[model samples]
Target: MQAWSMTDVGKKRRENQDSTYVKLDHERNMALLMVCDGMGGVNGGAEASRIACEEFARSVWDTLSGKISGKEAVALLEKGVSAANMEVYTSAISDPSYMGMGTTLTAALIVGEDAYVINVGDSRAYHLKRRAKDKLKQITDDHSVAGDLFRKGSITKEQYDTFPDKNIITRAVGTDPQVYGDVFELKLDKGEVLMLCSDGLTNMVPDMAIEQVLKTSETPADACQTLVDMANRAGGKDNISIVVFIKD
Candidate 1:
């Protein structure tokens, strides 16, 4: 597996509230990718994102260090996220300054040809599989108000685009005392790619555009840079973070 990641303070945002981490455990043939988009005013958002990512990564590394099965590793990942959520929530409650601080988390762990995905809030995980010479498929869903409205048939494609609160997430880590994340597993082939990104990239670049770029790019780093460039060209309204992993 090959991994590439980057985070940028977009054209508009004064602070980069997004955080990302990617690590490969060669001995276990496992790779981990995590992205978090924090929410709050001033530096609180960035702090929350940093804390969530660091705690989650530390917990996962510690829990999975022993000889554990793949299923057990997956369970450990969930527990790590839950622990991070509680820590963030408790800290925010104790400190009135970070009262409403929260963050969206999406993580992916790849072992052999199988990948496990877990997500909370609107940050996304996408699986890009080559169907033909020029076709790629995206296998993930956004968890936002606009996504819900679109799913419920209450909003059309145009309405989703024009929705004022499209960035408002219905659920997020640290927002509630306990956070539940959606988990998924995927079987990957040689040419498959897994992308984990904050809403900044998705809100600016459409899924089809992402597929095209991933299909055209020669490497994971190139794909990640191209996506970031495309998002910036499309107004760059928020902080952007992206991680791309390709099966070798």
Candidate 2:
């Protein structure tokens, strides 16, 4: 397996409130990938994303051992999300400046031939088959108002694209006392790629353009850098983050 990740503050953002993580264990045929995008006032956004990402990764690292099963991988990722959410929530309530801080968490755990994915808020995971002509498959659902409206047929595609409150996410990692993440499992075959990214890239670049990059890039690192450049070139209104893993 091979993995690569990148995060950028973008053109307009004052600071980068995005965090990412990637770990690969060849001996065990395992990998972990994560991306987080924070929201709040002052420095709370950055702090929230940093803490949540670290705590979530720590939780998984502490319990993950040799030869994990699909069920076990799911449990570990779920626990990691819970741990991250609690840590962020505690920090938010304890500090006055971070009272309402929250962040999106999208993660994937690859063990053997299966990948277990967990997500909250709007960050996403996508699956692309290297040898097939299939279109990119988004693995997670957005938890924002516009996403919900569009999914439920309450809003047309054109209206969703222009929705003013599209960025307002309904569910997040640390906004509530307790949080749950949506879980999904998929097969990860050789030469296939799985990507985890923040809305920064999605909001700026359309899916078709992103698919083109993933399909043509020579390597995961190149794809990451190219995607970041593309997002920045397209106005870069938000902090951008991307993490990719290829089953080699």
Candidate 3:
């Protein structure tokens, strides 16, 4: 497998509040990827994402130290998300400067022929394959007001696109004493691509455009860089982050 990741402070953001991580183990044939998009006042957002990522890495490292079954892998991803939430929540309450800090968390774990994913807030993961027209599939759902409305059939596709509060997420790490993440499992195959990214790229560039870039880019790293550059070119409205892994 091969992987690549990149994060950038877009044109409109004063500071980048996104954090990413990627771990590859050739011997074990395993890979881990994560993306976090932060929200809060001033310095709070940046620190929240940094703290969440650090906590997530520690939990993943400890839980995935040895070979684990599919059941254990699912449990491990949940633990990682919970650990990150607690770390950010505790820090936010303990310090006045970080009173309302929170962040979106999305992770991808690929081991053997299986891939596990966990998500909170609005950061997402996508599955891309070499296929006919529709090559990119969004693997996670947004945890936002707009998302909920759409799921309940209260909003139409046209309305969802113009929803005024689409940016307001209903669930997030560090926002409450207890937080839960949506977990998923996928059966991966050779040459398939799994991408984890912050809302920066998704919000600025549509899914169709993302597919075009992923298909045209020559390498994993090139695809990642191209995604970031494309988002920036489209009047970058937020911090952009991209992490992708290709099963070989």
Per-candidate TM vs. native?
0.93, 0.97, 0.97
lDDT of 3 by residue, 45-65 (tens): 898999999899889865677
Candidate 3, residue 170: the lDDT equals 96
lDDT of 1 by residue, 24-141 (tens): 8877778889999999857778878888898998888655654556687679778878987987888788888888899999998777888888888888888877555644554555
Best prediction by lDDT: 2
Ranking by TM-score: 2, 3, 1
Clashing pairs for model 1 are: none
Model 2 agreement with the true structure over 63-158: per-residue lDDT tens digits: 786877777888888899899999999999999999899999999988888999999999999999965477888999999999999999999988
lDDT of 2: 0.92
Candidate 2 deviant stretches above 4 angstroms = none
- Worst ten-residue run, lDDT, model 1? 131-140
Lowest lDDT 10-residue stretch of candidate 3: 61-70
State model 1's lDDT. Answer: 0.85
Q: Write the number of the candidate with greater lDDT, choosing between 1 and 2.
A: 2
